[model samples]
Target: MPENTPYSLPKDSKAWQQAVDSIASLLPEDISLHDFDALQSLPVFALIVVLPAKVPALDIHHYVQSWVDEQPSWHLVTVAEDAEASFVDVDVATNGSTGTQQPFTPAQVFRYLLVPVTDTLMHPGKKTAAAHIIDDQLTTRLRHDLAKNYANAQATDHPENAALVHDNLVDCHILSIGHMLRTHKLACFDMDSTLIEQEVIVELAKTAGVGAEVEAITEAAMRGEIDFDESFVKRVALLEGISTSVLDEICARLTLSTGAHTTITALKALGYHTVLVSGGFSYFANYIAKQLGIDEVHANHLDIEDGQVTGHIQLPIVNGAKKAAIAQHTAEHLNIEMSQVVCVGDGANDLPMMAIADLGVAYNAKPIVQARADAAVNVTGLEGVLYALGYPALVASKS
Candidate 1:
């Protein structure tokens, strides 16, 4: 009612227009407004404004406090820079009365865990048990329950003893959270030993009768014990005398890792631009991409001569650095920020691309890869990623 107070005005009111205009005018020229919403459920008037990132000089607290000095019951406001950040209002009634109220801070800490669905059904208390280990006061929400018998949980106020909590849960596979979980747009995957169950080259080697030799090289390279390029050349040389038809046989037998299809389907359905970047040959990556309906594919090309393997690969191999570059290039092409990309792989070479992505998930990865990744998924299949992104069980099931 006072002229100096910050009061709530009707959406159509000129007062509201002036307030919006004033805020916009105060923002820096480079800063852009992303979203603004009025709280409809809250009893008191409140507004939430979303910006791109933190701004040092944009202090709305001082502006609102000055107005509050005049009109005690005017309105409350908050600003958030993170796109996925949200606020939840909590009201507590004292002495069994409903009028008095207090608000708690927004839920900042987030936890992600995976448990066997059968275990959860058999022991429903397991969910509560895991929650207690994180934070007794916090609540856990079901993110996803895969058809493969695993379920994902998201919780607030995650404890500092997160690793201990994960260790306590017998069936729990992954436990991770933070900015990476909230903001990811693209999902990139490595081909060999990641999306698929085995290395295509090793399979080809088996057909060439050099399986033992090639497999050893592949393992050493993936473990980061040997240079990928050097290992690739040695492995390819072993397949030189093998006929090109071996590729068809290998592709026919290529088995996707558990939940690979479901994971890609869910990611695409959620509006992610899926890509397959591999050090493996396009001979296999292209076929897999088509079958999986991936949006993009980048991989090496194996040289062939006279209907047989030439034992030589094309230049500019899709090594770790190349994979990272492709991931960045794809993000630019999609016009999405790098913070929106999620990369998943299993070997050392996949580390570079994973590092560039907002969330790097090691899917049954080697020790070195897992150590460097933002998160690791060992027990569940690829679909576990939906849980990492905080998708609800029902939502992933529907996908």
Candidate 2:
């Protein structure tokens, strides 16, 4: 390679060694360096050395499978290219020269191999770690070079038609594998309009014989016409003294919007720390969470006395703002950045939580929410949420 080539190594034929040195200097000095030469043969096109929020060695990729299996977002980028895809094993040794080689998995992007999820790179400690000294300009330049290279590969050799390919890229490069590989965390979701399904509440209320009244309140609350707190109080009060068992009956009659189940299940398997933050009651939320093995559940707790509702709700109803608070609390407890969290909801009440999460998904949500969310999914199943998080393939059915 020419001396001026951007990806070139030093004149000493020690590009890998020098790269190791640079990487070592950024990590703990007590750590050793293993053989880095094997990494030279692969095309990494770009590299992003980031500081993890917490749990520096956290294996984020393990939780990333669902996104790939479900939405297959990254496939869009590769679809635009003719480059052969391959995986390369890279060993990241923190223990200086004495470090032993431990198997590290990295995806080779064209010529550039990436260590996308490195908890060690971002030392999560009270004091700033030594690795922070890498020149920002150098890192930025390296990433830009990578993005440029990938862009070229997709534009030129990609097999799909130009227009369709162009349309896909234009719609979102954020969902591409490059972005996912570059991203530290992913947020998955349930759709059926929980993040976007249009009228789950209204439809259900119809069966409950309170469609018109419930629909009016839903409309008002969603339009931000009435205080969410007050609207919830009024709405639930209308359901007062209704049979608590009616909820189970409601579940039997419930109809999930197009993508509800698939999206939730896939995200759960992928380790997104999924939560059923719903405006709906515990009746449905609990069932959905249990079936999907969701890590958290937040919904209206039906105030029941003697197998019947007390004609009242438990104080501090789970409304829009409360939903947001729960999500924030989870992020804090996990010691993760809010950006690592995801919130999905459909109604006006869901807006608060959606607004607060790192990636708010307006799943089949109200138009107002759709306008405000970080992303939106209109795909047939909740699985569309997997796509929003940058997965490009459908999850294999688990028996």
Candidate 3:
């Protein structure tokens, strides 16, 4: 190993050839090299080596360290051990401009940075410092720019305190940088209180002159204090004799929650299969889905006769468990993996489906839902989901 060698591999130099030859000689015959790569930044140089199972981790570390020490520059070497694989990281310290470090390719892992978009540009050096603290190999693209109030960066290396580091980002709602932010092919949402501002049943109750009684039942059911099916039946019974025209009127008056349009529009443009699985009535859900361009809508059907509500609901009410089933079925029908699905909702009835999805987002949801969801967005609109999905503001805009 030559002393004072630059951090980068000199493709055309004798020193590079010698270093390669030395590494090959040091490896045990039983341990075969799976991959080899070199990464270079201004003040840091890294050589990544991957090996298959059954290699002695400590021995490789000691030998690699000794080899690195023979080099001219001060090099820091580390090793990562896995059940069937191992990675060696070598960082070289040098004198250079300590400005923004250009993104570098990592060896065998990916590093993710979860930060609030508003605070990302405000603290330009925070990311660099974070990368160093985590001992990441290189910073990749800002996965999500300052779009919908969140941003993320992808890099190399695994950080043990990933959650803690993510929470440290100022005003960051979620830092699902690593495995949590997988490519989602399907997205399922709850209609009432999630995609829309007011509950459709409550709106119908007011027209039926049972608003107060039905509202209490609705609230209790949403709070998980009552059985969804029973409460739903009770609420619908109060609307008996009400004109069917109420459904059309209520649907016309429905108000979409903030960022609802933006979120669904962006998801559609990104090729995501959007689904609205509601415990509410299809009378309203179908209309909402059409308006939002949702690909699918599944909800309860209200029975009517003589142009009036019969106080009867069709079979197979869409409850919590059913919602989950719908999500699973949708994923399977589309041939998407379960890990590639995102479910969002705001009520207790939404819990089951939320639990089954790869990433469950609580959108201004109930306390219980927020507590259990994988990610929660209480302060922002539905658009915040775009950020959670790792879509940058630039990409969101194009979508």
Candidate 4:
């Protein structure tokens, strides 16, 4: 086995054949072809490493493999690399007969780095001729150990991307082949600070002559110093008597988060059912959802009377609890399991839904949000969310 480098997925058709040969080597000389069925039933995991496009494919395999070495329990069966992500087979996950496939354990989840590594690194090497190989069943202990390794990896920084800020780490994530084969059908996102770059409520407050008060209250809510419902009520009350036209004016000037269009397009193309679930007004969530091609929206409705802000909310405010309920109902209605539900947001209120989601994403979120979510994306754009969902160009080369 190589000292540091770990195994990676096959890069192309030729390397893929070599990988099959490695498995064949484990069989006895007189083993019959009928025994191949056992291999199919055996669990398999791909240590998908997504690097910045500028980085050489070989470095990506090496960078992640090195980290895998630190984990004592698992071993690379074989190592190969590719410049493009394997055909995800998006249709294969959602369409056709899936009854035959074995169900993955709920403990098994799709995990990834929020921001992929870039051209720079502290230790760069190539895939080696050998790997720290191991053959073990998918036992409960192994599963628990692998999960622990993932947590350790995230807390431990990569050789590169250890910058104080403006960093991208060689973050390695594991997902069972079973989970990977299931279609992630629903995508729920918070409107303010997520789809769009600004907070719609704060924008409305600025126009309503309550900008300072609202911003202060919003910051306090994020800081967990005040309750979301109370802060929201106080903030909205300050916007009383504002013209309804202000809603349209604020929506027109807001900018979508960087790489938002690309991320949403990629999700839709992959056949995901996109939904906007925000604590902000339906007025803004609906507008942004339309522009991004999102399928549905759930948000708090702001009350207006005589073409002016009434500063009152309709019943059932969409707080953290409501967000989780919405996500749960959406999954049930769509016939998708909670394992296929993904929630992305950037504030304290978004945490509840994230907690219940299959994959919780904190996008350019506060430090506390980043600490708690399944994954956090602060250095990169909205496209980083795609990486968390197994969409990055996981590159590699022949070992």
Candidate 5:
């Protein structure tokens, strides 16, 4: 190996000592390089994250998996082909002299880790126990919680705070393993504030001279502070007697979410089923779905008379329960399991449907929604959901 090759540490060097210390910090005080083999034989499973080389500096084959019957592990160097090299390896000298044996070499990309879900990691204390240091590498043990609680706990509560604790290397979460990407046949989306940028009712409220009032109620419902049913009715009543001309104008001006086009088109091209299940009005839902090439739509129907707003919705409001039922029925109708579905949304109304799907993603969601979701995509657009469905980062980036 070249003298200057990065991440290549000479045997018995200071860097090597620091590296060993880092790994040991994630484990018990007595564990060391000798314990690696024994630990690999433990009868437990963990959620492993191999961040693919999404960024140039992070050019490692990244992936995540949770299969039972396998031992818990933090692999620094697993076998990956051109795009499969996920972790860093420590190629140490085996001859007990200067650079004699070939251990795995690890890049700065997380070599591998074995962290237990300590209370401190999940619910960080007000201040660090130790003083801040420039060369620190933050680590959280993804131990054998086997259950998805570890991922969910880290995600729901001030996950961003954890990122700051790690100096921002932590991007998102992969809590539970969903159905394999290949099995995904259907993708369901919420319309207001999710599939589309603005809430249909809130936009309609603007034209009805009650924008502030409706917007307040909409925000409250989305945050789970107010019941979605009551909030929906109150907002609609405020729109009474509004002209239909406003509906058309608002629908015409409606915009798709930033990455919605890329996500929907990619799904269709790949032959995946796509649908819009919204608590928003059918008129707007259908309009957005048609434009996005969505296959179906189920939404609230607004009653109108003489081209003036009646503000009365027809039977079977698409509340949270209805949203989930629609998702289930769609899956059964397509002869697929709930595990084959991918649900994405931004509000409390979206949670039920998201819960039942194989992979439920909260996209730029309210704090309450993000906390409970299996995964949350706070930094990106709808295309981020594709990544949650196990799509290649390259595939999502193209969108």
Candidate 6:
């Protein structure tokens, strides 16, 4: 690699001095460099570099293929220098695929700037060869090759990546770039019907022969037809006379949702703060949390004395608003942006908290909940979340 300057320009930096210096050394002498903005708002690393003089509009379409093959990260967003027109501002989005973004890794970043200097841009003398050798056909071919390489890498690196596998299987046209996984610092999950299969209230009510009644309310609560707080109180009241041992029984029989284990494990591995916030009973929540290795559990505490339900809750029922409060609290405590947190549930009450989270997911939720959530999954497993996070099917399956 040639000893070239890296794109070390920070967001706040006024000029990409190195990029400008390089551009000036190659392009026509009249083409002067100007200011540029690091479009940080985008999910991918994009920069909108501006120039005072009009850029070359030559139909050097032949260079497109070479540029694509040689510089996968560079895309000609536009070619103009008009001040009032946004088209004049070049939108340069980074190809964060395997090779491009790898240089920005922690290890690479610490090892001095790893600039991408190819033989094409090397200095032969005072004036360097212009990179204007690109054409439309070449550009098209390059894009196709880059996309193929990206897909192949995805398959090789993450065979179980569900979305990629699904797309490939269906032969869907995968967009070049879209949603980027935001840095989520916190994650919140709903207990019953989401994290775990069993609803503690309905199961406990089974012992009292009121299973049908409590279940109806549970279903209604999840469907968003009934008030979560009221429905919960009515259900708990039915289970008041049951023995506390049943809690353990329910815990023993509880089944974790598909992908729950992998999702939580992966999130934890990535240093994400997770919480189990549920409208379900704490008895089952606490036990299931332990089994799944969760960091926090927030649910309704059953009022049991002498190993029997008192037919009443202790205090502070975990309602919809309360759930949202807990999620916000965790985000604030972790000093993470709200957008860096994810809340997931499958019930109507979960809507409040889900709305507050940076990313809200409705896992096999009722129609009402699904419509309100940012993302909804109707599948049998929790792994669908991996898709929303842009984890190709292969990676999700592996973990």
* CA-only RMSD, every prediction: 19.2, 16.6, 18.7, 13.9, 16.3, 16.8
Residue pairs in candidate 4 whose N, alpha carbon or C atoms collide under 3 angstroms: 11-81, 81-396, 81-397, 82-396
lDDT score of residue 270 within candidate 5:
57
lDDT tens per residue, model 4, 341-389: 8899999999998988767888878878865676666435676676656
- Which one is best on TM-score? 4
* Backbone steric clashes in candidate 1, count: 5
Global CA lDDT computed for model 5: 0.58
What's the residue-level lDDT of 78 in candidate 2?
Answer: 20
Deviation (Å) of 152 in candidate 6: 28
Q: Give the candidates in order of lDDT, highest first.
A: 4, 5, 3, 1, 6, 2
Error of 4 at 336 (Å): 1.8
Cα miss at 318, model 1 (Å)?
A: 0.6
Runs with alpha carbons beyond 4 Å of true place in candidate 2: 1-208, 395-399
lDDT assessment of candidate 2: 0.44
On residues 1-399, what C-alpha lDDT tens digit does candidate 5 reach at each position? 322122311111122223334444454444433443333322111122323232223222322223211323333322121242232222211222112211211112222222332212221121111101101211122222212332344456757533332212223443321122125789999988787778889888888889999999999999899888899889888989998888778887777775676567667755689989999899888888876779999998888999899888677889999999999999999999886788999999999999888678788798788766766664355666655554433221111
Q: Which ten contiguous residues of candidate 6 have the minimum total lDDT? A: 105-114
**Which clashing pairs does model 3 show?**
3-72, 4-72, 111-155, 144-392, 145-392
Give the TM-scores of the predictions, in the order they appear. 0.58, 0.53, 0.58, 0.65, 0.63, 0.57
Best by lDDT: 4
Candidate 2 local Cα displacement, residue 65, angstroms? 30
Better of 3 and 4 by lDDT: 4
Candidate 5 residue-wise lDDT at 365: 90
* Candidate 4 overall lDDT versus native: 0.59
Q: Report the lDDT tens digits of candidate 6 across residue range 1-399.
A: 111112221111212233234334333344333311121111111121111111221222333324435665443332122223111111112221111211111110000011223212233221111211222233244345434544665667766652342211111111111112245678899988887666777778887789999899888887878787788788888876787767666666666775576567656755677799988777778887876679999988878888889888766889999999999988888888776778888888888888877567788788788656655654225655544443322110111
